[model samples]
Target: MARSTYVSEFHFSREVRRLSGESPAALRRRIMLERAAWRLQRGEAVATVAADEGWSSAEVFSRAFRRSFGIPPSRVGAEFRLPAPNGLHFHPPHSLWLDGNTASADIPALMIAHDIADTGYLIGRAAELSNTQWRQPLSPNQVVLDWDGPESSVAAVLCGTVWAKEVWLASIEGRDFPSRAATDPASVDARSLAVHHDDIGAHWSAMVATMTADGRLADTVIDALCDPPESFQLYGIVAHVLTYAAHRRELVRALLSRLDVPTRPGDPLDWMRGN
Candidate 1:
C-alpha cells in the first residue's frame, strides 16, 4: 500500500494516523477483531473465528476479546461493535460501514424483520413448484399495486414481496427506477428472490440503523423524478414500506398455503421461536 502511494512505510503510517487518528496496523487489527465478534455473535465456534482472524490460539483470542470488550467471548451479546475512532465497523454478509452517530434510542427492528424472512420463505416454497403451478392464477385478475400490474400468481406475489423493497430503496437513494423486464412470474426463481431480499435487506437495515442513531427520521426527502415532485419524511417512508410490505407478505403466506406448502402461521411469536 505504501509503495503504491509512493511513500515509505514510515511515511504511510504517519499519514494514516494524521488522517484517521490510528495507524494502519491498528485499524486492520481492530477491524479483524470486530469481524470475529460479529461471527461469534452469530454462533461461530470461538476456535474457528480465532483461526480465521489470525489469532495464535483460542485462548489468545479470548484474552484479546475481553481486553477490548470487557466481557468474555462466551457472553457476547447484541453489541459486536468496538470503539472505532474512524467509525469503521464490520457489517454482515461481507461488508463494512462507517457509523459515527450513536442512537439516543433504538427503532424496533421487529416490524420489518418478519416481513423480509417470511417473504424469502415464500419465495423458496414457490420455487418448488413447476412453472405451470407457479404461474397459475391463484387470485385470477387480482391486483396489489395497480402500477405493478397483476400479482395473481404465486410466483408474482412472491416476487413482488422482494421487488417492493428494491424499488423503494432505489427511490430513497434517488436512483433511476429498477427495470420491470423481469416481471414474468415463470422466469423469477428463488435464488433471484433471496438475492434481492437479502441485498435490499442489508441496505434497509443500515438505513434504519443510521436514522435511529441520529434521530433523523423526521428528515424530508424530495423526489425530483416525480412529475409532480413529491416529498416524504424519512419516518413516513419507513411506515409506508412496512404497511405495504406487510400486505405483500400476507398475500405470499396465503398463496403458499393454498398450494399446500406447510408454513408456520404468520405470527411473530412463532417466527421468533423458530416454529
Candidate 2:
C-alpha cells in the first residue's frame, strides 16, 4: 500500500508566502491553474475541458496542463501512479494548480495540494530545461510570428523588453532591463524560438548576477531603480522565470490568435492585478 503524507498546516501557510512573491505572469498562470482545478473539482472530465473551456481540442489543455504542472492530467488524481518521487499535485486556494502524493480521497485538500506541487514543479522544470545544453531550437510554430524590417532591430529590442518584462512581471516583481538585441531581422528565423527561449534563461541569469554582484538593475529599469531598490532573494529569480515563461507563452498564443490559428485563452490582467 502507498503511504501518503498529510501536508502540515504550518507548511501550507509558509508556502503561500513563498508563492505570493511570484511576478505578474506567474500570478496569471496560477489563476488559470486555479480555474482548471475548480473545473476538475466540479467533476468536469478532461475530455470535456476543450468544449467547456473554448480550447480547440483536449490535447491543447493537456499540453498546457503538463507544461504548467509537469505531469499529464491522466496522472493527476490520487491513486494515480507516480514516477519515482518527483511527480506533481494540487490542493486548494493556492492560485496555481498541480501536486504529487500518494492516493487521496479529499477533493478540496487535494486541489490545493496539487496547486502547490505544480508551481514548484514548473519552476524546477524551467531551471532544468534552461541548464541543459541541448541544441534543439525554439518550436517551428513561432516562426510565422517573426516581424521583420529595417526598423526590425527596434522591434526586436521591443520584443526583448517584452521578454524581460515578463521575467520581472512573473518573478522579480521589480523590473530588470536584462535583454539581448537581435541584429539581423532575417536571423529571427524558425531558430529564433530556440534562441528566444535560451535568451529568457540567459537574460534572467544575467539580471540575477548583475543585481547581486553589482547591485544594479538592468538598463531597462535604471531610471526606476535609481534609488537602490530592495533586493530580491534567489527565489525571486525563480519566480521571474516562471512569470516570464507564462507571459511569453501567452504572447505566442496572442500572435497565433491574430493569425487565425487556435490559441489558449489568456488573462494577462490576472497577473497585472497582482493577484
Candidate 3:
C-alpha cells in the first residue's frame, strides 16, 4: 500500500503546551465511557458499554470498575449513574487522570495511580510532539508517511501518515470507521515508505504549500479533514491533521499499555479536551 501523508514534523517542546495537563489513559477512558453511556441512555444493553467504550472485554471493564469505584458494576443501578444524552461530564479530581482517579485512601492504590499518571504524562508528551511544531527527526516507531523519507522525525512521520489518510478520505468524502464507506478501499494500498518518498514527494510538497497558504485552520475545514471528501479544502486538510494527531495519540497510548510501558494517572476528561 502507498504511504499516506497524514501527519508531519513536531517540536516536542511546543506541542506539549497545546496538550498540557492531560493524560492519555484518562482521555481514552473518558471517550469510551461516554460512548457506552450514550448507548445505555438510549436503552441499549449494558454490554453495549463495552462495545462503545472499546474495552477488551466486558469482564475486563467490570473488573476495572470494581477496582476503581468500590462497587460491583452490576449492583450500581442505572439511576445512580445515568448517562447524559450528550455525554458524561467526568467530575473533577476523577477527571484529572485515568489510571486511577479515585479518592480512596489506600496507599497502594495511590502508588499505582502515580505510576499510571507518570506513564500517561510520557504518552501525552509524545502526542504533543505530533500535535505541535517540533522539527525533530522521525524515529522508526512513528507511523510512516508517503511524502517524507524514513529519516523524518517520528512525530512528523506519524502526522504525515494521518494527513494523507485524511486527504484520501476528503478526496472521496468519506465518514470515519464503522461508516459503510469511511475508508476508500483503493487508497488503503500504501506504498513502502521508501517507494512512497520517491514517488509522492512532489505531490506531498504541493499539498503542504497549499496548507501553508491558509495557516490556523477554520472549524469547517477541520471537520472536512477529519472526515475527508473527493476534493481538497486547506482548512479541512489541517483539521484532518489535528484530528489524526489526536487519533494517533490514542493508538500510541494503547500500544504503550499493551507493551507494559508505565503510565501516569489520568481521567477521561483530560484527553477529551482537544476535540
| Candidates, ranked, lDDT | 1, 2, 3
TM-scores across all candidates?
0.57, 0.27, 0.23
Choose the strongest candidate by lDDT: 1
Taking the tens digit of each residue's C-alpha lDDT, what string does model 1 give over 170-204? 77777888875454466766666667678777788
Structure candidate 1, residue pairs in collision: none
Candidate 1 lDDT score at position 192: 69
Per-residue lDDT tens digits of candidate 3, residues 1-275?
01143333334323433464323345445445544544544565666667556778888877766664456555554433323323335442234223443554444223323323333344344443322223343234444344433423433433344345445443433445322122222222222222333333334344444444555223233333344443545455545544554444454445445445444424334533532
Worst 10 contiguous positions by lDDT, candidate 2: 128-137
Clashes (backbone N, CA, C under 3 Å), per candidate, total: 0, 34, 58
| lDDT (10s digit) by residue, model 2, range 156-206 | 322443344344534453544443343222344324433454445445445
Clashes in predicted model 2: 34
State how far residue 57 of model 2 sits from its true place (Å). 46
Question: What's model 1's lDDT at 86?
Answer: 82
Question: In lDDT terms, how accurate is model 3?
Answer: 0.42
Q: What is residue 68's positional error in candidate 1, in angstroms?
A: 43
